[model samples]
Target: MAALPRQQHPDLLVGLETADDAGVYRLTPEIALIQTVDFFTPIVNDPYLFGQIAAANALSDVYAMGGKPLTAMNILCVSLKMVAKETLQAILTGGMDKIHEAGALLVGGHSVEDPELKYGLSVTGIVHPDRVLANSGARMGDALILTKPLGTGILATASKGRLATPEMEAGMAEVMRTLNRIPEDILIAGHIHAATDITGFGFFGHALEMARGSQVTMTLFASRIPILAAAREFALMGLIPAGSFANRRFCERHLQTAPGIDPLILDLLSDAQTNGGLLLAAAPQAAQGIVTRFQEEGCPAAALVGEITAPGKGIIRVEA
Candidate 1:
């Protein structure tokens, strides 16, 4: 908050210190430009799917602000010696396909030689100034809804199992490889208020981000929070990813566990995600409608997990 030009600009909705998705620059009294960029190593072994997920993740920051992704430029870091040039081509092609799907054009790109392949996009998007959703817009009574299921971390770990089953791989791949576009669509359609995509931070870390950003306390029902079927097995198999530890370190201060809570279930809440979905804060009337909207869009797992309270200074509690 201290780093931004908030003193000079009044319309900067959210920036470096607020934990918001993108930095919004007001173009006019009624229009704003949203900008965000991201790139990460492939979360999965499939180069093409990795490209697609990377593009989606990068674009998600814009959508998290209820903005439309209008354009992007590819960002690549490739190892010319280790991986074949063809793999990089397929990777870029996959990213291009997703950008095209979102009606965003890739005008150009830059590449660098490295030891490993890294790909994503630098996305630019547009939104009406008044309609821009900031993480702080969440009200005390706003309902909390998660647009996707948790467990990508555990599942991905399970995928590395020596006896990894085809079914398990299929499940984890679909979750990690998919985009958060639908939740963005719903938010843009005015079905939600504040929105944020859950990615590397995992579900609880992101929840803490929103709670702290909004200066509100959030109470979530453990039973209602959705999880993948394979997460438990993965945890039992000790397949948790490294990011899980980071998430816990950063977010542990705000979380409050309930009695008899399964430790693995707790871990799932901290597991890192790839192309995760949006967590929306909306009014109750709009909350049910939002769930229905996701379901109609074929997202049955979408759930209203909790609600916000008066600003509790920071993340308040995470209980069953």
Candidate 2:
């Protein structure tokens, strides 16, 4: 993507420059369009649930950009000869349900036959031109709040290996299918400086992007990060995903960990998440309140996990 010629225009609010969650283009003086697309092969056994998770994950990019999704189109890839007709219908139905839940219309879509089944959406949303949120605006003294727990990658690996308990599977499914929609009242009250959804990059990977983009160092309290209880056990059992290791390697040079920090915790931090929560950098004074409201609104795992410290070249410092 870096090799592609950079498109410069007066209305391009957010582009490929910062690797933000979505592309924003100003349509008018008051409104801007947020566009993003994501699709992946099955991560769960149930086709319906997989569809819901994929749609939610794709829609999350718009939400992370502080936009409200207005419409979505299905992106499907499957082998018609190999997949059952009922299964395909279930997947489409599931995606439609989530799109409606987000108050967005599913107007149309395109599909193709492939060796593997894949599903997701192409979402278009709108936001105030002045209020577009990008991953590059985090300021020093801002509190980092994560809206969901970590460890989905490890749990999924354990499930694939048949080592995960039923409870663990259920927990992982719930986290993946849940949407990261922040209420309007909280958005207005939180004074968010920057935001991004935790997805394929893992928590540390995305946070590193924010730190680098804002040109500041981030200090994380390892103990404060929320993790699914079973993830630690699975990670210790060596059920970590290959993506987790790659994410760690990608961020290691810029990462600084304090002595005595648990290796298992670091593994969990680097675990690649599917359809994870929104990580918001908010004003310090209102950070706790925003978290409280998130908890009250059914996001029980939401917590303040870190903060921007000082000017730096995208370095992350983790403490026990």
Candidate 3:
């Protein structure tokens, strides 16, 4: 993508150049359109639950961009012979539930028969041109808050292999199904400097994007980072996913850490997540309030895990 020719249009406020979560294009003086699409194979066994997760994940980008989702088009890839008709219908129904929850209409969709089952949506949203938030606007001294705990990736891999307990599996599923709309709304009303949802890249990978985009450094307090309780055990038992290791490698060059941090903690920090929570960079005075609102709104694990530093080499400094 870096080598691709730049496509310049005056109304394009945010695009591929910044590694932003979504593309924002100005439609008028007061409105800008936010567009994004995402899909992946079923990570869980339940068709309905998988559908909800996929749809929520797709819609999260719009919220991360500080916009209100407007409409969505279903994207399904399934093999009729491999998947039951009822199962496919359940998946669609599950996706619709989340779309409706976001106050977005389901306009249309496309499907293709494939051996592996997959589902997601192409979501479109709108935001005021001046109010649009990009992942690149995190400023020095801003406090970073993560809306959910880490370890979804590790627990998910364990579940896929049938190594996870039913309780653990259910917990992870619920987390993935939860939407970021609440925190986005609260932070936007508070002091949102920049925002991004944690997804396949894991915590550090996404944070790296923010730090690099804003041309600043992010100092993370490892001890305060919330993590799924079972995830640590899974990591110790070697249940970490390939994506987690890949994310570590992807961001290691720019990651600086204090001495004596456990290796497993680092793994958790880079654990790739699914429909994960939003990472908000709020001003110092409003950071605590942002976390309070998240908890009051039902995100018990929300926390202030880090702070932004002056522009440097676009690095992340982890305090053990």
TM-score of each: 0.91, 0.98, 0.97
Worst 10 residues of 3 by lDDT: 181-190
lDDT of 3 at 40: 95
Candidate rank order under lDDT: 2, 3, 1
Cα lDDT for residue 189, candidate 3 = 75
Give the clashing residue pairs of candidate 1, or none.
none
Greater lDDT among 1 and 2 belongs to: 2
Query: In candidate 2, what are the lDDT values of residues 1-320, reduced to their tens digit?
Result: 99999999999999988899999999999999999999999999888888899999999999999999999999999999999999999899989999998999999999998998899999999988888878888998999999999999999999999998888898998899888887888666649989999988899999999998889999999999999999999899899999999999898889899999987777899999999888899999989998987888767999999999999999999998
lDDT of 1 by residue, 1-320 (tens): 56655444687766677778888988888779999999988777778888888898898888788888999999999878888878888899989988988779998989999887789899999888878877766788889988778888777776666545777766767765555665555555674668898888899888887887777888887788878887877777778888897887777777777777776767888889886778889987788888877766646688998988667865646566
Candidate 2, run of 10 with poorest lDDT: 181-190
Better of 1 and 3 by lDDT: 3
Which pairs clash (backbone N, Cα, C closer than 3 Å) in model 2? none
TM-score of 2: 0.98
Clashes of 2: 0
